[model samples]
Target: MTTENKGAFYTGIYRNLFKENGYSEDDITAKIENTWNRMFHGDDEMRIYSEVGGDLGYMVDTGNIDVRTEGMSYGMMMAVQLDKKEVFDRLWKWTMKYMYMTEGENAGYFAWSCGLDGSKNAYGPAPDGEEYFALALLFASNRWGDGTEEPFNYSKQAKDLLHTVIHKGEKDDGYPMWNPENKLIKFVANCEFSDPSYHLPHFYELFSLWCYPEDSAFWKEAAHASREYLKIACHPETGLAPEYAHYDGTPNHIRGFGHFFSDSYRVAANIGLDYEWFRGSEWEIENANKIQAFFSDKEPEDYRRYTIAGEPFEEKSLHPTGLLATNAMASLAADGPHAKENVELFWNTPLRSGERRYYDNCLYLFALLALSGNFKIWFPKEK
Candidate 1:
């Protein structure tokens, strides 16, 4: 029973289904709080986070046994949304202490991955991480004014980082994270390709307002470029996009990232959140419907890697929980009847427990937050 969407994204307000679907306010609040507590600090086998000495803390990649910029910034976003400044600061301290570089091509960028002990696993930065870092840090600064500390000047740090994201490689050792010719985010600083999931136009839209004033125009253009990039990168029928793609929106096969897989899942979720935040595009609702419809009948264990054209491969999804979480998030702009079912399916699913728990749990928590309308923008309080 697919309910065809006429134009759902036109409505500016996002739905709080937890409240509307008969859950008590107390229950909804308790679920959000309890989920956060357990995921971050619960039993060892279940928790992804760890505290270091007195200052730094990190969310480990349980499956890979490393820390990633992805998790760190994600943890910051979760903290800011939950008003957990202590956790946010601890994570930020760790990022600054270990991941941030001081010199060379990638000086301003945080290393993409590192050991749980804070040693570098890779020297290069992931643009996805920087995007989250800037957004979450800006939110932190707004939610809680900068403390008199170097790394704690959240907004300033965010602005400086954003400045580097757009300006690096102009005369530096490395190329910029974004393509100077097209404004599309690169897969890495020097790459000619982009990871479609890295295109967070919604974040870019907000960045235009909060980033370094001189770079504001760039972000606005980046947002427009990314939005347009997605339209071509994604399949017209399936809305599935490759994990990596060229600036012209063709899949990049150089590293076998041509298939639609794990990283691609975030594209739907980003679009959902983008539509919820800015209501900038009507096509968002249609894309949400297409992706949801394409996956509506698929069972979790049977989920397989597929091409953007919807051709399936033998490979099963490595992060099935994460995949489902993002699909559920698509409900933010989804108009199909399956939209409600997707949210309900997610609600019934527990946090994935075990080695790959880190990514799964992170996405699950985010989906929970977004569906309930708890995921939101933060602003400095009125004077």
Candidate 2:
């Protein structure tokens, strides 16, 4: 079968879970097992699936393990959402065992991207991964309840780790540095892009939801500052955000590396949704719309070849035609006219069968699941 055909098959299975007929417990179980066996259980350690098996080499930033964490968290979230306690328990334990939250060089936050053998490979800190961990913890805590011990215990730990990032990981400039070591903030110029920004506002949102009043106030300040920095960094004319920006909020020289994905807009949207800051929200909507406009102007045949602002973006064939861009567009419009078309294009695309690019595929799937409101599919379902 063609790569596209395999993608279609998987997408069809994904659709069945949400259809009026609703997937049977057995059906869901089988599907989860298939994904787990094919992708999750491999030596890749929760890596994303690509045609070439799992891509373990792609690291997002210093401590951020975007591909693995997204897949693991999404899978765990789906397990909880579907009430699949067994699946949730297994994946959760595995994730916790491999993932660690400790006092490291930077405010002692969670370390991102350990190898499959549980070795720490990456050193950069990213906002998105931190936020997802907090979200997962919150979900686990809420589901297991206050008194419940097992999951809630871990949830509390996750929450604490998130706080560390917000309070210690961020530099005085408002943007988060790569790592905080020796009471010093280490900034990586590459993280100024929109992809990592998604997690920045979550610091405030999660704090509001979980932190004490004193702590929450501090987090809120950090969140606001991050937003201000983002506004300064993003391009006003093209609405384009760079892969990295300077501490002074200037875009970096690199444009296409981390800048091409839908997470760029997702970060902006998430910030808007999480905070009262109107500018972040407005920018999120505008950026999302701009991406849609860029893609819509081209035919599907030409979509694969299309570039962002005429700059060649990596994995263009895998991206624009996939769920990431589609759902990003859908989130912006919601019930807007382009919603159906975007969603359909994402769901119906044939980008799945090609050589697996773990990180990109994971992000793509994460956006798709988020768009469908099927967070449970990637997490544990309520039993």
Candidate 3:
């Protein structure tokens, strides 16, 4: 490799170290403790756990409870990765007991949100939460094996919930919204939000692994639909995707925070190799490259700092815009000559160490797992 390449390689490694270093012993311990306290003893009147920031910051409770699910799941997985078995065990128990089960119309399937006191405040289902739960449970199953039973059940429930969505086509306006009453699909939120990026591709992968051979086509279709929507949502010039878009894929009226973030990276990562799913050609490869190039050309300066015309991108921290750049590098499929360097920049940035909102942390965890190749439930052991 040339000098520039060598520098890039070290940069990438440095970013990983920065991310690893951010979590001091105290920070990790406190997060684990907080998760445990909230899961078990935080609030009893609500019957669900209370996340700290509701929808805005670290402890967001999307009506589906996905924010908390991903938070706790990532915390436990991180503990396990660090060989903190006791912490992992405790988090596992709390999630399995209180967080896993759903009540009301969504009974049997997991819910999206619960009250601070552990009561079901949002009695709806979401694909993002289901996908995260599936991956987490699959990890637990493999990590603990026959020694534990929770992972097995959690994984089963996740798969079942996904099956329900695929078969029912349980969505409105070309997106999967929530049906709080019957836990069925309804149009509660914006029609074109990118929230499904959480598990669209994983759904296909999981189905291929567990579902019968004849039933694999359905999962593929679902993944394709998600990819198509992404292609529609992506801004041709800036490569940034809006939080909500029209069912036809036009930018919705609501321009949330107005900067690229981890959700876009998640969608890009999931859409990898399956370029044919979008334009029926290799356009996805080019699309991925376009997004990568956009980020690479403007990163470290343009990152998290958006501008319209001459005005500075005033949106500050609605989405932690920089984190998505990190995730894009860490997760998006490399296509261009600068792909590795771009990935390195994203992986090496120390932005995640700062205080973050709920979704920000969840995306950080997702980015870390993507960079480490730990996101996949069935990835081969590193040699």
TM-score of each: 0.95, 0.63, 0.61
lDDT of 2: 0.45
Superposed on all Cα atoms, the candidates' RMSDs to the truth, in angstroms, are 3.2, 9.9, 9.3
Worst 10 residues of 2 by lDDT: 180-189
| Candidate 3 or 2, higher TM-score | 2
Which number leads on lDDT? 1
- The regions of model 1 sitting more than 4 angstroms off are 1-13
Q: How much lDDT does each candidate structure score?
A: 0.88, 0.45, 0.45
Q: Which candidate wins on TM-score?
A: 1
The stretch of ten residues in a row with the least summed lDDT in candidate 3 is 6-15
Give the runs in model 2 whose Cα sits over 4 Å from its true position.
1-71, 81-85, 101-107, 123-125, 146-152, 169-203, 222-234, 247-249, 254-283, 299-310, 313-329, 332-337, 375-383
The TM-score of predicted model 3 comes to 0.61
| Best-to-worst ranking by TM-score | 1, 2, 3
* CA deviation > 4 Å runs, candidate 3: 1-67, 73-89, 100-102, 115-117, 146-155, 166-196, 212-215, 254-265, 269-281, 297-313, 319-332, 351-354, 379-383
Error of 3 at 304 (Å): 4.9
Q: Per-residue CA lDDT of candidate 2, range 3-107, in tens?
A: 332322124223222222243556445544454454444444333422212322222221243335555565555445545555555555554555554444533
